[model samples]
Target: MCRWAADLGDAIFLEDVIAAPSHSLIAQSSHAREAKSPTNADGFGVAWYGDRPEPGLYRDILPAWSDSNLRSLGRQIKSGLFLAHVRASTGGATSRLNCHPFTSGRWSFMHNGQIGGFEKIRRRLENALSDDLFDQLEGATDSELLFRLMIGEGLSSDPYGAVSRVTSRVIEASRVAGIEPSLKLTAAFSDGEALHAVRYATDDHAPTLYTAAFAKRAGRCVVSEPFDRDGRIWREIPQSSFVTMTRDGTSIRPFAPATTRWALAS
Candidate 1:
């Protein structure tokens, strides 16, 4: 997995910090200090909301550390909502269509981590998708499958519910395939108006996920990890939780498992 960030404010300040700091996303790609595998150089992507209602996306099969176009674009474009991702392919092909921050209609999504044993249950999962959504599939990645599943489950209206429902279905599919699913997933989705994120895992212990706020300090920013050691307000998001942010404020809530009926219906 690779580090990613999203920011929503008066203007977009999104960048693939993969190469910015001393221990940036780019550093993580080739020499990750946290994961067993130390490389995440498969591909990278970004999405940002501009004047239009829909978000704009940029994806490349190039390593973030070597992408000059990304560096140039990151410095020039600005928006109020944005998402960035650095990928290390688990079971997916190395293609731009399989990149994160996938967009459809007016929504955008990005994911971190993998769906363990995805190959075992991929057929089952695919069978459950509606023809309309199934036909739209452009890549063969579990992340993209999860996104489509959420959409088929009605994410446009209730994002939290859709995610929970899909999670439950995936878990069930894994069980039937005689394999326990290990899902270490941190995700963010937005519809140009509201932003939502979830940090979850099938195991009792999940991966690192954090959130922070400016507090009363002006011109300050919050992120996954502090830019520096100034941790006056940076806080870790609790395990198995979801967050929602808008112009008004941010909300933290428990992420409950979806009902059996809800999962099968969708």
Candidate 2:
């Protein structure tokens, strides 16, 4: 899994989520305490909305800590909405295209965790995509394929529902292929207006996923783990839940499972 962070305001400030003291994302790249693997040196990427109408992206096949360019860029850039990721490849080439913060039009997406049984079910998943989305599938990672599926499924209007449907389809397809798919997914997506995030797992015990909210009015910063004990308000997002934030405020909602039983049964 990768680490990422996004800030939304007059502009977006998205960067690789790597500001924590000890177990920060940068730290995890070297000595991960929770991941199945201890090192995430495959690559890193970041995207943030800038003064232009479109967001800016910076990606490289270099470890986050070792990349001086990213360090210099991080200090120089600031936006109201931004995204950053450090990758651990799951069968894709370690290249810039395979990095996170994949962008399409005004939308940007970054995912943590993997799609279980991806290789077995890749063809089935691809066949389900629309021509337009299929044409745009650039890299071969399960994450990119999943994003295209969401786009082809018309998820722009209702992102939450779209993601749930896509996940359900992948899981059902994997089952048909005689693979017990166990997905661990936590994602953040934005269309330059609102940001949506979800934490979910196919098995009950999914990979560790958490979210923290920071309120300027309340003068608090919440995170996956406590960054500081400055006596600010911070809380963990419940498992199998989704959160959406806009200019007004943030709202939490339950993740409604998709009705893919028939699809699986077929």
Candidate 3:
């Protein structure tokens, strides 16, 4: 299992949200209240978009709760949009490169699910990427490859379409290979402007996701789980849906890929 938090709106310190909340992300790194994997101690990464076109990235193999550099940086770095992730290794080795919030150019992504039978389908997915994206692939995780696939699929222009097309391809490949639970995903993607997210799974049990509105800061946070237990503080994102959160507000829609899968199942 993996966990992620994304903030969009006015520039604010990262710790204010990830560390200061009642049941903060740092607290969840060791004792997650919602995910199947309680402790996400494999690694962590943060991608914060500041003045540059590309976001500043910091990833380490240390757990989020124990990393001093992360806490120090979180207090200083402020961004209108930023993403932080804590990873729980599904099966692969724990390495810094495998951490979430993978970045390429201006886009940053964090994911909380996996490609079913990834070891079998990894090659097929890699073969589908262009030479440029293939070279840019640094980590050996399904999430990184998926991010590259999205970039190749034109994430800069059509984020929803790109994610749908690539995810459909992955699920089809898994099906062709006789892989059960073809794909499960709850991801956040941003290009320094608006934040876009999706939750879908071939198994109909996609990972949990929520949007916590911060009226005081006048921003929004999309999290894998609510920071606190308060029901009113968080609004859950329904299964098989697409969400986009901008400075103005957030909008939700049914995700076509999951809809297509469910339609076929019925």
Every candidate's lDDT: 0.75, 0.72, 0.86
Candidate 2 ranges with C-alpha deviation above 4 Å: 10-24, 215-232, 260-266
Q: Which stretches of candidate 3 lie over 4 Å from their true place?
A: 229-232, 258-266
Q: Model 3, range 91-209, lDDT digits (tens) per residue?
A: 66799888988998889999999887899878878887889899998889999999998998788999998898888778767776677646888999999999999999877899999
Candidate topping TM-score: 3
What is the lDDT for 126 in model 2?
86
Q: Between the candidate structures 1 and 2, which one is better when assessed by lDDT?
A: 1
Q: Report the Cα RMSD per candidate.
A: 2.9, 2.9, 3.6
Highest lDDT scorer: 3
lDDT of 2 by residue, 190-231 (tens): 887787888788886545544454443311111323333343
Which pairs of residues collide in candidate 1?
Answer: 12-79, 18-25, 18-26, 29-40
- Clashes per candidate, residues 3 or more apart or on different chains: 4, 14, 0
- Give the Cα error of residue 112 in candidate 1, in Å: 1.2
Better candidate by TM-score, 1 or 2: 1
TM per candidate comes to: 0.89, 0.87, 0.94
TM-score of 2: 0.87
Runs in model 1 lying further than 4 Å from the true structure: 16-24, 30-33, 215-227, 230-232, 261-266
